[model samples]
Target: MSDKFPDQARVVIIGGGAIGCATAYHLAKHGCKDVIIVERNKLTSGSTWHAAGAYAQFRTDPNAGRMMAYGGELYAQLEAETGQATGWNQTGGMRVACTPERRREYERAITIARSFGVEMALISPQEAGEIVPIMTTD
Candidate 1:
């Protein structure tokens, strides 16, 4: 960290949030030098600092789902690639549908996810209960 800011930079990014920092990282990774990030305050001191470390990969749009999948894959390998410990655990999650309409929506989502190679399935209430024994299916 340098107290003196550069007089000139080829690229100047506003904000120091996740997206901004990610953009800067990718730009530098692709050999973009003289990139400067202008933050209002310290990095990630805004909403990003209080963000819940959770992400949903299932999406109705195939392209969005694929992008989400790519982010998941990137997070899984981030620690190894950057030598920085990112506590990302890939524990498979479940979506509980309380109504027939929700179930149908889940089914449609499953189809879309499968089409883009995202593993998803709609399980029966009994099956779901078995997976989480403490959960009351009724």
Candidate 2:
């Protein structure tokens, strides 16, 4: 939103959310000289504000995992590179297997994450309880 309206742009992106901003940055990085992002409000003021900023390393699809990894990388460096805080926190995530079926799903996710060089462990319920004391193993 540098200008209300840019006269010219090699790429015109709608919305100034995280996704749109990231898209604009990459397009410019890859040699798109002029990139313009139009936003109804300030950048990240939309759903980005409400975003939990969760970075899931696991994805059933390898391509999706890569995309998520790239975003995580960007968030990790956004503050350092541009001197602007992206409000990104690297808080860890957990997938609670509340039932046998959910445990199977976690197992699949673990395999997929590991296959793409992402680290994910399939821990026992007891181990999980050790990390989260309030967790109910029943």
RMSD of each: 1.9, 2.1
Candidate 1, 47-128: lDDT as tens digits = 7787766677888888899988887887898899999998898887899989889888889999988887778988888999
* Stretches of model 2 off by over 4 angstroms after superposition: 1-4
Per-residue CA lDDT of model 2 for 108-136, tens digit only, reads: 87787777667788888799889999989
Candidate 1 Cα outliers beyond 4 Å, as residue runs: none
Summing lDDT over every window of 10 consecutive residues in candidate 1, give the lowest-scoring window: 47-56
Models 1 onward score TM values of: 0.85, 0.84
Name the best candidate (by lDDT).
1
Q: Which 10 consecutive residues of model 2 have the lowest summed lDDT?
A: 1-10
Native-vs-model 1 lDDT?
A: 0.87
